[model samples]
Target chain A: MTSWLPTLQTATPEDGYDLAVKLARVAVKATQPDAAVRDRLRPEYAEDADALIAVSHVVATHFATVAAANNYWRNRT
Target chain B: MTSWLPTLQTATPEDGYDLAVKLARVAVKATQPDAAVRDRLRPEYAEDADALIAVSHVVATHFATVAAANNYWRNRT
Candidate 1:
């Protein structure tokens, strides 16, 4: 098996977001390792508005999970 | 204007990924604040394979950006 996750950490909200995106991608790669397959499928959704919005929802879900983990990035100076 | 980004910090890669997803969603929300519009559009993409894959790509792109910020989480014990 491949190592999908590394020691996760972030210093800013932007960093957190970037890591979240990576995690999402890593999940997809784990589910489907073939890049060609993903590439072939990309165009279909790329142009669709509905698909784009759906993507945002997925990202948001991931973000919420991350926020919980970091306690919403609270308790810092 | 809505503040999409809060003080970001993560303690694990998973946390970072979650934040990344949140960032992506925040971007979308910023672009389109109307929740009803996003909800209506989600189903169309949710059921489509291409759209789903596209979502993964978007997430991956975000991850890559995050990874760079964290130096690929490289220098940590």
Candidate 2:
């Protein structure tokens, strides 16, 4: 099957945001050396599983905001 | 050199912030398909060189804020 992925050229803010979210997840996992740490990282925002996903969204939003600001400044100049 | 880096067990908010900034820089570089694109990413904040560095700070601050919030929530639970 042909892959739908596009060739690498440059990342738009959206792409940066998506990548940031993925990287954050990896970093979080790297931080967790044991079940205790993983359990501690769990959120009270929602259910245990849902909380973890929400954390991803929170980090993603932060990244997307910065990426948008970067793009805005890039366009301005 | 001792490298001074600690083993990865858990990340503090500061660690997350620093890692976010570095990862963002890599992602930005990966996004550049050509010299022109790289040039365009150049900022006009201070001087050309300073502007680029400032961009990292901006993104880092955002990451730090989110990380702090995450920690707060994690602790609360």
| Cα lDDT tens digits for candidate 2, B1-77 | 34221211124656656645554444443333355544533433225555445455555555654454344236533
TM-score of each: 0.49, 0.31
Task: Assess the local accuracy of residue A9 in candidate 2 as a C-alpha lDDT between 0 and 100.
Answer: 22
Candidate 2 has which clashing residue pairs, if any? none
lDDT of 1 by residue, A1-77 (tens): 77655545556555666566566566767788999998887656554565555656566556555655655556557
* Candidate with maximal TM-score: 1
Encode model 2's per-residue lDDT on A1-77: one tens digit a residue: 77432422223434545545555555667677676776664433222222322344445455645454444223321
TM-score of chain A of each: 0.77, 0.40
TM-score of structure candidate 2: 0.31
- Docking quality tier of model 1: incorrect
The prediction achieving the highest DockQ against the true structure is 1
